[model samples]
Target: MSDILFTSSATAKNGRDGHVKSSDGMIDLDLVNPAENKEGKGSNPEQLFAAGYAACFDGALNLVASKKDKQIDSTTTAEVSFMKDKEDGGFKIGVTMNVEVQGVSPEDAEELVEAAHQFCPYSKATRGNIDVKLVPQAIE
Candidate 1:
C-alpha cells in the first residue's frame, strides 16, 4: 500500500536527514552528519532514536504528573541507551528518566514514575516488541 498525503523532498548526509515542507505542497529533506565535525558530533540512528525516546518519555511523565494532581516544577531529562544485540539483529533500547519534581515525596515520585511508564507512548511501543529498560529516578 502506498500512503501519500503529500509529496516531499529529502536530503541525506552522514545518516542525518532533514524533512521540511512548504505551503505549496513542496517538501524538502536533508540528511545531517552528526560526526562530520567531531567524534560526538556525528549523526547516527541511536541518536535519532534517543531524541524520540527522550521527548516521548518526558511528555508521558508530565501527563502522569498532571493526572496525579501534581505540578512538575523542574525539568525532566531522559537518557536513552541503544545497545546492539547481534543475535537479535536489532538494537536494544534502554531509557533512564531523571525527573526533577521538587516537593514531591519518594512515594509520590515512585507513583509518578510508574504512571509515566504505564502511560508513555514510547514505552508501550518499545515494550515487548523491542528490548527496553527503564530507570526512573527523582531529583528533588
Candidate 2:
C-alpha cells in the first residue's frame, strides 16, 4: 500500500461521486459525475472541463507573460464553453480569455493566447485527442 495520506473521498450518488480536498482545504471538488450533469445536485464533466481549462489558460498565460518579460494580473481569467456539435456528432469546448494587463498590446495578447493554447494542459488534452472544438479568444 502507498504511504500517502488520504484527504478525501467521493461516492456516486444523487448524480455526484465523492469529493477531495486540495492542499488548501477551503476548496474541495467532486471527482465524479455524469458526462453532463444536471445543475444543483451533482456536477458533470463539463464543469470539470471548464474549471481545468480556466486554470490551465491562466497558468499558461502567466508563463507566456513571464517569457515575454511582461507582467500580468493574476485576476485575469478565461471563460470556457462546451457545446454540442449536432452535425459533427461530438462536443466542442471553446475558451475565451479576458485579461486586464497593463502595458500589454493587442498583438501581445494574441501571442499569449497562442502560447497558452500550446502550453495549457487542458487545451492539449482536448485538441485532437477528444472530439471537441477549442477556441481561445483574448480580450482586454
CA-lDDT, candidates in order: 0.62, 0.60
* lDDT, residue 34, candidate 2: 52
How do the predictions measure up, each by TM-score?
0.63, 0.57
Name model 1 segments beyond 4 Å from true.
1-40
TM-score of predicted structure 2: 0.57
lDDT of 1 by residue, 26-110 (tens): 4333434443534443345555566667777778878878877898754556666656677778756566666665658777777
Candidate 2: list runs displaced more than 4 Å. 1-39, 74-82, 87-100, 129-140
Per-residue lDDT for 96 in model 2?
56
What is the alpha-carbon lDDT of model 2 when measured against the actual structure?
0.60
- Tens digits of lDDT, candidate 2, 16-111: 466655465554566554544445364454566566667767788788889888876543455656667777898765555565444466677667
Question: What does the lDDT read for residue 7 in candidate 2?
Answer: 43
